[model samples]
Target: MQYDFDKIILRNGTNAIKWDGLDKTFGAADILPMWIADMDFEAPQPVIDAVVNRAQHGIYGYTEKPESFYSSISNWMKKRHGWQIDNKWIEVSAGVVPAISLSILSYSEPGDKILLQSPVYYPFFSAIESNNRVMVNNQLIYENHQYKIDFNDLESKLKTGVKVIILCNPHNPVGRVWSREELEKIGELCIRYNVIIVSDEIHSDLIFGKHTHIPIASISEELAERTVTCMAPSKTFNIAGLYTSAVIISDDTLRGEFKNTMNRLNAEAKNLFGIIALEAAYTYGEEWLEQALPYLEGNLDFLVDYFITKIPNIKVSKPQGTYLAWLDCKELGMNQKDLVDFFIHKA
Candidate 1:
């Protein structure tokens, strides 16, 4: 079946966080709403069909996650990323953000330092601060039009007794698919410091070109023991509203801690529809994802060409993964506030 990604559907009345709050988020309703991470396209027919089929049943009761859901997730991981994830290691959460919050609570104590690479997904900051933990930034070194981890800085931060490192693998905004060598270096640093790594691989499947996402936990047995890998079909299948995400903890001790935290907070159960949508997406949404990546790449290319040829003052660092385009408007000779105003007016 042919996918129509270019067909922009009307989302104004759907209570979409992207479209509904345009004026509130950007200070104007006229701006093109590209700032949010979710896509503009509808999810695959298979996903929609599954949700609709479940809705038809009309039995909204407390539900248990089936064995098929776990199997689907494991199969998808092995097939797409060459990662062998056992069913026993998986923990369900409402979303990755919640999982991050829970990880902070489970693994670290108050006043402990949690390391993050910036300028990252803004929520990483909140996840740290909201839990009464100190946020330490090992800010990425931006050089040669790409973002690279500063290992020396990371080591320094680790030495200061940071308990955890939250990584945005195939990172957001300033997109850079972390290489194997980079992942290894990070793994080494975390191991050396005895710090836990929370690898958010939410965008792992959204990669473009020859770029590949490496799960930090899958780096090695020792790294796996220290890493908590968070993944979901939400971003890939455009199903964020479903609130289904998987947290893979390879180590039994860490997994037990995470599970205990979730159980204590009563956050372990999956949403009924979330399970249905997740299973369908992972099992049948592969071809849809495969097709979507090329269209997104085209969109990135179009945006780059448009910015270069037409909007010469604005520079977009071409993304390695994810649909988000980090636009550099410093050349517009305007301050950050002015640039935002200009885009709001122009968009």
Candidate 2:
């Protein structure tokens, strides 16, 4: 336990969206902001050291991602997730959303269809519709307070000519880590229908008890060919402001298409500090993560207990992955506005 998670870090005036943007976004300076994904803690010291070292070097120049960058990613994937990746398979983007947006541009024509699972990361809707692609949601099945993929519905959507499907591994909001079998089903479906899979796996590293995140690409070579697996240290290491993410496309043609799209917009290169911070994180942040996860799980346990004991009316779904807790606000009988008001004003 080298790092402390219980200490509340004051973030006011730090320009942090979670803390500083509260007044601007919610029209009040006093509401405790918990809507965003970023954590309230500081990054591990090694990541801080790397960024500070880069800053102190005083040469802020355009830089290319070196071979070590690829090595760190490859090694991390191999050691942590049991997936071996070639350096050639990796590509850089500012963030996962940007990578998905680029995936939309690279793989599909305007007016084509893209598929997603809902209630998913809300940005998937924007990434599809913003790029003039039709958004198709294969609504998830929520039974007994757990989310399961509706394979029949997903297959039905693919039949409508979905060119791409964005997967949120260890899914956002509702945190269910897709099992290997689940990924196999998804991969097989994409192969059968020729739908390219764009997996937004930014939350992959934050998995919880008895849940493992199998990269949809790692399920098989064919799946890898059709899948663009997007990941970042930003979520795991709390560095989203750095704007760094990795997009892995195993097929040569798909990789070339993605690289071309990035080149056209000069988005291939990563931010200088992001580059250093990412390498440091993947290489040295494992120890910090081992400690951070239990703290997160403990936090969830605390919330569940507190709710049952003190606020018996509220129900929360304990997450299998990610720090997010999806609360069932239904018992309060609040509409959308009422829900927002209750969180902001009532409790």
Candidate 3:
């Protein structure tokens, strides 16, 4: 079935964080919100159907994760990325950011150093700092309108006894889908320095054109052992409100420790609707995603053309993956606040 992406449903009164917070967030009530990561489109019918079917049952209670839940995720990983993951390696979490915070608690001590590439998903900074861990910014070098990792800087930071690195695979904001060679370089550094890598592959399914997302753990058995790959159908299927995600730890020992941490914190349970939505998205949302990517790419193209033709001073880094277009408004001779104000006023 053809999905209708052009129909702009009014989200203003729905209490959407993206829509409702425009005034509070950017200090303007009238700004068009292209800021949040969630799409303006509706979720696929299968996902909606699954959640509705679960609601029809009417008995919402504490739930145990079913074997099918694990199987759906495992199968999807294999089918989508050609990566083999056993059901035993899966850990359920409410979301990727929560899983990362728990990983900080599980693997690193307070005052231990964690590495992040910026300007990344802002939560990466929050996850480390809020957990009482030190954050090391291995900031990406922006050149030629694309962001590249500064390996020399990363090596220097890793040498300082960093304990963990939060990697954004198909990174947010800057939108660089890490190449195998790039991931191998990162893997090499982490392996050598004995740093635990938390590879958040939440945007793995949203890539465009020849760009492909390589799971950092999939590089090698050694790397997989040191990696905790956080993934979700939420971003892929536009179901962030579902709050379901998978934390894949291939190393049995690491998985055990992570599970122990979850158990200690009592955060292992999955919501009933979350479980059904996740299963449906992984099992049947592929075709919808296949269609959605091109439309999003079209949106990216439109933004590019619009900027070049109408707003030439505004520079947008063409996203390699993910729906977010990182617009460099610095050249417009305005401070960050001024740029935000400009967008708000214009929108």
Report, for every candidate in turn, its global Cα lDDT versus the true structure.
0.90, 0.89, 0.91
Q: Taking the tens digit of each residue's C-alpha lDDT, what string does model 2 give over 145-211?
A: 7999999999998988999998998899898999888889988889899999999889888888888
Error of 3 at 226 (Å): 0.2
What are the per-residue Cα lDDT tens digits for candidate 3 across 173-258?
88899999999999999989999999899999999889988888888999999999999988898899889999999998899999
Highest lDDT against the true fold, candidate: 3
Error (Å) of candidate 1 at residue 187 is 0.6
Candidate 3 has its poorest 10 consecutive residues by lDDT at 338-347
Q: How many steric overlaps does candidate 3 have?
A: 0
lDDT of 3: 0.91
Model 2 misplacement above 4 A:
none
Report the lDDT of model 1 for residue 67: 86
Model 1, runs deviating above 4 Å: none
Error at 12, model 1, angstroms? 1.0
TM-score against truth, every candidate:
0.97, 0.97, 0.97
Model 1, 220-297: lDDT tens digits are: 999999999999999999999989999999899999999999999998746988999999999989889989998899
Q: List the residue pairs that clash in candidate 3.
A: none
Error of 2 at 57 (Å): 1.6
